[model samples]
Target chain A: MNFSSPLTPTPVAIVVGASSGIGEAVARKLAHEGYAVALVARRADRLRALCAELNARPGAAHAVAYPHDVTHFDEIPALFQTILRDLGRLNVMVYASGIMLPSGFSEYNFGKDRATLEVNVLGAMAWLGQAATYFEQAGEGHLVGISSVAGDRGRVSNPAYHTSKAALSTYLESLRNRLTRKGVHVLTVKPGYVDTDLLKAVARPFWVVSPEQAAADIWRAMRRGKQQIYTLSRWGLVMWVVRHMPSFIFRRLRF
Target chain B: MASFPSADRLALLTNFGHSIGSVAYVYRPTHAEQIAELYRSAAGTGFTVGMRGAGRSYGDASLNGGHVALDLQRMNRILDWNPGTGVIRVEPGVTIGQLWAYTLEDGWWPPVVPGTMFPTLGGCLAMNIHGKNNYVAGPIGEHVAQFTALLPTGEEVACSPTQNADLFHSLIGGLGVLGVFTSITLQLKHIYSGNLKGYAWASPNLRQMMDEMESLKADSDYLVGWVDGTWGGSGLGRGQVHRAHYFAPGEDPSPAQSLRVEAQVLPDTFFGLVPKSILWQFMRFFMNTPGAWLTNTAKYVHARTLDHRHHFLQSLVAFNFLLDYVPNWEKSYGRGGLIQYQSFIPRAAAAEAFADLLKLTQRRGLPTYLGVLKRHRPDKFLLSHAVDGFSLAMDFKVTGGNRPALQRLTDDMSRIVLDAGGRFYFAKDSTLTREVVAESLGPDTLARFCAMKARCDPQSLLQTELYRRVFGSI
Candidate 1:
């Protein structure tokens, strides 16, 4: 019952979408916390900047930038192997690489929705499956995936992004159920409107949280061994109401 | 400087304690973006996570093994320092000592500071430490303007009183259960000179002390007292109180400013010291006995007559002279160790509760060591322990069979505190039944906490001993 003691250090943490936004923050946090961080992102400049920052620390442990597109399955083995080669071990993999097509589902391009599915769903699965194999072989590992609060339920606008997150959440949940006894961990994180570039581009009114605050929430959920959590706790209540609202009353209002 | 394997490989290589080994991985992100990436990776791996700021918390409040430990020390940078308005924006790693050195020169001091000087602003927010000034300034949370945290969803969010209010409330005293705190903006209070308008008073009984404490709460800016708990009969629970105020700016600085004058008391060597055997004998008999009154009374008079504040000696050093002289004195307790039982009971029941507490201690014949009582104000910050009541903190040195007796006393006292609708402070806790914690701090709060965890960290990535004891494993 005492949670004061945690398991052990992870050899390597492969953070997807380490270019910017929440991905970049998690990468920095993990690397600083003693994980040999593998920064996975497309923007080489930004990743290199982060690597330099981590390396510049007076007694920094280990961190590096790996420019790999999550959408490319062929990059998984090499990207992960490179982490093992450089950091000496691999234990945690985070899927934070994501893109949002903000336009209404009806107005957005069909191709954009497909790309969202491909990058968020298919691409995440490719890397996550590889991570599962790595952890299963070692008999211990953790997999973290980032989802959106929009995934709590369907919305009139941006149905594709919401659907992608909701689907991702379900996939992680199912994966956790399967891996619960295998020493492999799967976590799904759902955040409300984060004050990231993507959310900043939208016309959000009431629910907007800063990236740092969001990171703190993520850190807490992970620390408490919580299977799931909302980045901002109140969003759970908001979702509760949204899920239970009467159809007649709900259909008339716009969130 | 000590290096260990990653969380996964740690079990294979070394043996760590239940509390010490919980750190699976440790990350120190310089920027907020990197923390997001760490969250992303940790979520997929299902590794629990925790944040550490200077790691000054005496116990395991900041440690979580088999999980990632986020170190915010490297991020110690002053993002903004507005000397004009006394508002400072700093990373979570900024230490109280660092902040004090910077602002004290400008005639300002941190509104509150715990006994230790090395704790960080983030740690302060996490524990919500209160000082003697708690009666006047309230807890550290009330002065916080805003904080940015990195969440498990790889989201970087900023929360303040006006924005994301729930998060703001939870993070203040949530014990890092919510997230890794990054940067914080806090409002510093204006101060005059470092001189403290000091007054020393003695109380003959618990009621007299409580009466003086009630008055001190309203009239003084900083107040604290030392109780001679060993006193029994008419002198039982008698003590001395010290109240201090900030000297006005234009007041004469000569009397308050004796440059290097107070250094004369600094001990160059242990020329004459009390031996362990003698101290043990004293503790065994006269330590908490009525005969100790004469010794304590003389000690107070001697301490009161010390040279007042001087130019060279800073306020921080001047305020804690007693601590400087006796270092690690607690080790004198032999191997039996000790436990500090601190409680907060509503002001209405304080007199009777304290009287009952003393009687119980006396009946048990346990050493009624150093007892301190202070006044506190009510606050709205979630997880805040402050209440409009009287808080009593005592350190009991244990002997051979005293542990159980202490536990029983604590349980009885906890019952009184719970009955008065007050809660125990987490930072100074080793006891306090889970049921009591649940009852005192509504079980619904844990439900809400669990539901939030269920939604965000469905993989149960975070785990701490305290969480396991109070909140079951996911």
Candidate 2:
């Protein structure tokens, strides 16, 4: 279907974790749809590439690369200010930056698990929190972040990763509760088996969706102003069973 | 001055074929000054530069190896639009499809667009692409009022019919050489309705098909024929000619019905509802020689069975972008992919040229699937592929072992086309020899083109794998 939007000055979308995977695709996709995109990521090189690719599309709004690590949450305030100063406006904040590492009970590493919490939970809180506040002040804006289906269940393989996502999902819900009173919309995106660079070494799953598709789903959910969504139809079903399963059955089943 | 995209940012890029290249640098400059800055930077780095639109070029035309490639898709914006005159100025990255999408509601359309609407406006002008109505309207370049070409030395020169006339002619079909097209202002056409009145007529042979195409051209504003290449004897190169005319509101009973286009999405057919990659794989196998021939034959036979012609009113999208529904379907052309060869022969020599072209491919056992024929009149866009006659385009699946043999087959076909007084289009050309190019355009044309380049881009900053392949680097 032909997509139509008002022919006013373009809106701005700050896409964090845009250096790779879903964020990269979102930055490009939003730029094509007339959203001036500011790409944020830790890797300057990757963000630069994505920024170049997005900027070169004809009739598309501008895309700029802003390399900033989410782990260094303090820097985001200045980064958002610079984005506002340059792009003139902000309409959406998409936080797809997070880390995950597989650690079993015997081999659990405190540093790796703590790093995941700091990046996924603390980082999301700082960045998305600021976006929530800004958008609430502006009276209209969307705040979207990538949580995971792992949050639905405490997985033994990567408990830290699951806990971080669950924490993130709760933080987003609480933010949404507070922001709804004011004019901000918060969306939590939970993806299952997304074919990203992070999943390259893993066995190919039957329903692994591409980052491009994942980005499209997330953008669609954000546009529809959904509070939360499980990307891809099969994933929604898969997550449903996982989320609703009796704790007695869930604990016994090693996943 | 703004910096160009770094080497780390520029990974190997691919288009249709197996050919891939890693540009040392890739840049997306939003303004003419930024593009000028990129050129200056390339000079200092001792690497040449090339322009890449949507990277729709099937071959290496847009691929730059071991050099800087300027990705211009970001410099896209509607610079100006005069609704009254139908003159719209757009950045190079805007796709022809976008132009149509935005303008069709206003009952206006770009005068010329290639079969697919994905290619950028700048690339279309560079290739001087032709539409089905080429016999009457000429190429896209003719509709272009002017464009700002950023020269290598940070000069943003305006090239049009009346200004910088030499550079204008050379740059028209200059294949992204001379300079980068930063801005383009085009004249659009006005149509009474969004739908086209069309029909598919079955032709028994190559000669009859060309005749049918000519007849269709005379009456219809847009004309294209699909020639089947499977059968060898009397039915050789036999196919269906699909002719169409823009509905003149008066003739169409419900002209106002199409004031707004119907939903662009196709309903989920049983097969379409399947996941995309699986559907793409299915289409690939479904388009193999035997399968495609059967479908084409069935279509031809089915059309011939009818005593009276059946006319259908179709939307512009239904007519032009029928292939777009199957996204990434070309990937199914096998792991190696396929190459599309479109040769333009003078109308007088077309019938004879087609026989030889058919014989060459048939004898080589190269399956010429998806054959398209179109009538055209010549345009003065120096590198324009349109001829004062008609052209036939076909896609040949490329196999690993048959690639060399396929090149030989194409080389032989090139000789036949050149002998019949025809030339190749650079956009689909991955195997065009320099000798044929020089022979077709004459040494004077190439020398003149090179002279313009040398004078404007002294450092030879603008070069792509296409330039290196078709024309040796300076």
Candidate 3:
């Protein structure tokens, strides 16, 4: 109950897009590990419910809901400070907000692609950029960005989604290189076919894992100080083979 | 005109010593209404406001990292003054230098002042600063007649010893968290002249120094001891004691002339030759361990042989404000800056506890470059650090390589102080834990302070890096 020790205040984490899927699971996991979690998302009702569930657990650490739309770039700076004020100190920030819109196989939809890139890439940059600046100054923190195995190659389906994932992975890699010497750790998580609402249209998805399983793998990688990781372990081999395939042969292939 | 909400701009604010810093959205308000409007704008906005006055705190007390910092320096205004009664009313941003300069000609002086004259009255009251005469005058808060403050809850209230007494006691030492001072009325000390009869003597060791101070407390108006922290063996804690007494009526033949502002201004040159502004550049050459050892030894030897039992007449400005004598002297500590570890221990355990602390720093080869010893008496403030004994402020030079070792040394020192029933001053502190604060304050006092905070700031709108570091977001 005494929070006076600057040497060891309860660790705090901010999980963006924590209303559902891997973000919510990671928030719950972080709270269980004794981190005061700030659940950030656009869904106020879902975040409120999640906060209640996380706060009900018996511990000094709990959850606070910060309903926010990540596309509101101007609000990120103030919101970041507010969360820091409420949580005391920040140790980890997980950018798990992403969206996958349905697109026709043969038709190109700029609207869908634009929305996908806006939520998936731009939002992560705005939020994680703030975290990066804070962590760099403090000399220590953790950053986790959720990418996807779909980014490994130019796939025939969901071009915008794959492009967003590739951009996120590269951005995380650049941050890792920039912050590795500064005591901050950046982790890029590439999960394959997670069973979340984002994948609702996919029928009989291959090697599909539950959201909790994917979150657990990501948490393990973060704890291990990994720069990049693939959920379920087997996806790493699949992605490697998919990436090395000849370009002419890959263009003619279909999933 | 810039409105209260739009006045904010990103800024990096550092403590006076430059030892610690933070980046925040800073807003400088010129009137009380702007502050009140700022609070309204911050209501339910998730960001907390930290009050800053001249940014003189040596640590994070004035820093609000990643939040709003309300700077009050521009609000300075002398609202009222009565030369006969020696009662002065001023806005919170007025500095000690301005106060003394404005009233010295009238034969009045601030009741209590720190070693530096640049700190604003708001900061002095927030920290309840002490002086060499603390054993007699208590802290500056005791001299306060009344004050008006605006709380984070959008309510302004007047408080004094007889009215809103609880707030009067807590707000003065609250570190500017409970509310922001709008204006303060203070009672100044009546003086006949600006000169003080001074005496200097050397002590063989810690025990002798304390004994001499105890013997001189009744007759002397102000007393301070300078310790050679690098000394060891039988000469450990060896230092010099400087005592001063005010000139009685008619004792000074030229009272009118001595009380003039020109008579008290500190000289800008050394012996009418070398500029004191560049003195820190020369001092930097001797900041290392070997150089410090040599300088400290030479200083002690000089004090012992030449200044032993020295007597002379000294101006009030010369007697105090030694910190301002050497401008940018702290910068000589290098890029890492410096941290002062000051502990107030009860008289019963002062000698042993301070001896252990001095020895611990010596054993680690991190002897303090400067050690100041002062006598203190218990006060009525809620979070008072004063003890009916002694306080030793040790200044340690920090560097990139020795930070880890310095941290360990402070940790060990904190344990010794805690075991001896000592308390810490937030203004001078860079390191302290919640457990230490809770143990020092006890549950009853902590609960009362927290209760007052809740009543005054229901939404927890006021905060600082120091507050969060010591009390968290609770």
Candidate achieving the largest lDDT: 3
Candidate maximizing TM-score: 3
lDDT of 2 at B41: 66
Q: Per-residue alpha-carbon lDDT of model 1 for B37-153, expressed as tens digits?
A: 666665644455666777655335665544456777888888888877888988888888678767665655678877656678988898788888887788888888888876666
Give candidate 1's fnat, 2 decimals. Answer: 0.00
Give the lowest summed-lDDT range of ten residues in model 1 chain A. A1-10
- What local lDDT score does residue A31 receive in model 2, on the 0 to 100 scale? 86
Q: State residue B207's C-alpha deviation in candidate 2, in Å.
A: 0.7
Summing lDDT over every window of 10 consecutive residues in candidate 3 chain B, give the lowest-scoring window. B1-10
lDDT for A58 in candidate 1 is: 65
Instruction: Score every model by TM-score.
Output: 0.56, 0.63, 0.78
Off by over 4 Å in 2: A1-255, B1-5, B17-24, B252-257, B261-278, B306-310
DockQ of 2: 0.01
Residue-level lDDT of model 2, residues B335-448, one tens digit each, is: 667788889999899998987888788888886877888888877766667778878888887764676677778878899888988977888877776777788877776777
Clashing pairs in 3: A4-B434, A5-B434
Model 3 segments beyond 4 Å from truth? A1-81, A89-106, A128-255, B1-10, B44-46, B152-155, B253-258, B269-291, B364-366, B398-412, B447-451, B454-460, B468-474
Candidate 1 lDDT at B422 equals 76
